[model samples]
Target: MSEKNHQGKRTARQRLAVEREKQKASERRRRTLIVAATVVCVLGLAAVIGLLAANSGKSSKSSTGPVVAPSGAQGKDSLAIPVGQDGAKSTLTVWEDFRCPACKAFEAVYRPTLRELTGSGKLRVEYHLVRLIDGNLGGTGSLRAANAAACAQDAGKFPAYHDVLFENQPAETDDAYADNNKLVQLAGKVSGLDTPAFTKCVKDGTHDGWVDKSHQAFQAGGFSGTPTVLLNGKDILKDRTMTPAKLKQMVEAADKG
Candidate 1:
C-alpha cells in the first residue's frame, strides 16, 4: 500500500472509534434520564396514594351521635377538651396530629405535668387537633383517632381516651386506626367510652368533618409542623433548651405576666 493511503486509513479508523464512543455516551445519558424520570414518577404516585389514603375517612358500622361541637371547644372549628378551670392563669394550646410519632413522644413526656398543672387550676389546655401526618404521610389514622377522641369527649371521657390512643399509637406508617373496629376496641379500654353513641359516631365518621376543620385551623394559625406547643401563644420549642421542668417554670412566668 502507498504510505499516504495507509496514513489515511489509520485516520479513518481513529475517527470511527471516536464516533462509536460518542454514541455509547449518548446512549448512557438517555438511559440515566429514563431511570430518573421513572423514579420521580414512582415517588409522586406514592405521595398521592398517601394523601388519598389519609383523607379517606370512610365510616363503617359504628354508633351514631350528635356531631355538634363539644362545649368549650376553642372555636366553631375546633374541639376543646379543657382540663383546668376556665379562668385559669395560663392557656396552653397544643397543635398536635394523632399519627405524628413526635406527638406520641410529647404526650409520653409532658402529659403528666400538663395534667398536674391543669388539675391544680393553674393552667387550662386547649387541645387543638390536626391531621398533619395524614396530609403529609397519608393515612386515615390521624383522622380516625381524632374522631375517636372527640367521641370520647362526647361521652365525657376525652382525657382518658386521648391518653390511651397516644399510649397505643401505631407506627406512623401503620394503618391501625383506619379500622373503626380498632378505635372502638381502644374505647373499650376507657371506662364510659364504649357505648352506642361512640360506636355510631365512629362508624358514621361524625367527627371527621371537624377533624378536617381542625387542619384548616392549624394552617390558619401559621403553623407548619406537628406537636407545635404554644405557651400563652408563644413558641417554646425553638429554644431547644426546653425540658418538662423548664416548661413548668415558663408557664408560671407566663401566668404571672
Candidate 2:
C-alpha cells in the first residue's frame, strides 16, 4: 500500500513539472512576438522621418530666398525693376513663356545684369508675359501662372513673382498642372503681391488681353522659340550665346550707334 501511494505522488509531481514547462514556453513566445512587433513599428517610424527630411531638404534647395541683385550694386539702385533708376539708354523688351526652360535659363543668367542696368538708369526692361506653351504642356497651369504674374505686375510685384515662377517651374510633363491653388500659393511666395486680387485675377483670366497682345507681337516678330530678346524692338539675342559680357558689349555698341 505504501509503494502505491509513493507512485501516485511521483506521477502528480511529473504532471505539475510538465505544466510549468508549457507555461514557460507560452510566455517566451509572447515576448518574442511583442519584440518583433515593436521592431516593425520603430522601423516604419524611422522611414517616415527620413522621407520627410529628404523632402524638406529638396524644398529648401529648390527655392532658397528672395532674388537679390549682385553684391556690387548694393547702395546704387534697388534691385527691383521699375522702382530702380532707368540707367539704360536703350529699352529692352523681353517676351517670354513661363514654361519655357530656355527662358528660365536666360533669367537665371541675365537677371542680375538686367537688374543692374535698370538700377543704373542704363536700360528700361519690359517683360511681356506670353503663354506659348499653355495647352501643350501641363494644361493651363503654364498660362494661369503667366496671368498670375501679370496680376503681380499690376500690384507692383513683378520682379519678386517673376523670380519665384522661374525658380519653381516644373518639368515639361503632364504632372505640372498642379491646380490654381498652387498658383495662388506661388504668388504668395513673392514679397509684395496683393494675394486676394492676385488669386481673383488668376482665376478669372483678368490679364488674358495682355497675353493675347503679347502673342500677336511675338507672331509679328517671328519668335519661333523662347529666350528672344528685342533691344529697342529689334531682335538682338536669341539663345545660349547671349552672355552677360556679350550683352554688355552689344548694349555699348548699340549706344554708340
Candidate 3:
C-alpha cells in the first residue's frame, strides 16, 4: 500500500475507536443514572411503608386494653354508674363514651338537668360507659379514657371525673386520651379523684372489662350509637317530642305515667 493511503486508513480506524469509546462511556452514564434513580425511589417507598407500619403498630399495641371490673357496677346490671337514689320512680339509663362528641354535648346541656333531677330524688340515672369509637376509629383513646372513668368510680368520684374528662376531651381523631398520664392529670381537676389507688387503677386499666360489658349491653339494647338515652325504657332519641329543652318535661311526664 502507498504510504499516504496507509496513513489515512490508520487514522480513520483510530477515529472510529475514539467514537466507540465515547459511545460506551455515554451508555455507562445512562445506566448509572437509571440505577441511581431506581434506588432513590425504592428507598422513599420503603420509608413510607415503614412509617405506616409503625403507626399501625402503635394502634394495635393500644388495643389489648385493661382487665379490671368497674367499681360502681351494680347487681344484674354490671354497667351501671349510678347517679341517683336506688329506688327513684324513673330510671334514666344513659349509654355514653368519653371519646364521643355527642356524648360531650349531651353532658354539657342535659347533664345538669339530669343531675338536678337525680339530686332531688325525681329520677335515677345509670350511666353506662361504652367504647365503640375505638373499634371504629383505630385508636386506644376511647378504651383508655373509659378505663380511667371506671377508676374514678373506685375513688367515689366517677361523675365528677366523667364531667372533667368530657370538658377536656381531645379531638375525635386525636389519641391523646390513650395516655394514662393525661387521664391522671385530668383526674386532679375533680375532687378526691387523683389518689394513688385511683392512679394505679387508671394506669393498669382496672375497669376495662366493665367497659367491655357496657359495650355489650349497649349493643344488646339494640342501639346503634353512643349517647343513647332512655327514660324508663323508652328510647329518647327516637321520640319525636324529645327536644333538649323538653327533657325535664319528658321526665316529669314519664314519672307521672
Tell me, by lDDT, which candidate is best.
Answer: 3
Misplaced by over 4 Å in model 1 are: 1-67, 76-79, 254-257
Candidate 3 accuracy as lDDT: 0.73
lDDT of each candidate versus the true structure: 0.72, 0.60, 0.73
RMSD of model 3 against the true structure? 26.1
Weakest ten-residue segment in model 3 by summed lDDT: 37-46
Query: Mind giving the per-residue lDDT tens digits that candidate 2 earns over 1-257?
Result: 69999999999999999999997676455434433433422332343344446776454221212322221212212221243445557778776777766677667657887887666666777666555555334256555676677667767777888888889977745435347777788866767565677788767766555454454455455554555677777765533244565676766676676
lDDT of 3 by residue, 1-257 (tens): 99999999999999999999997676455434433433422332333344446776454322345435676577455668788888678888888778777677667656678888888787988888877666656577887898898888888888898889999988777889999999989987987777899889878777776677666566556565667788888877665444444778776776677
Error of 3 at 69 (Å): 3.0
Off by over 4 Å in 3: 1-67, 75-77, 254-257
RMSD after Cα superposition, model 1 = 18.8
Could you tell me the lDDT of residue 113 within candidate 3? 82
**Global CA lDDT computed for model 1:** 0.72
Candidate with more favorable, higher TM-score: 2 or 3: 3
- What is residue 76's positional error in candidate 2, in angstroms? 32
The TM-score values for the models, in the order shown, are 0.72, 0.61, 0.71
Tell me how far the alpha carbon of residue 53 in candidate 3 is from the true structure, in angstroms, after superposition. Answer: 24
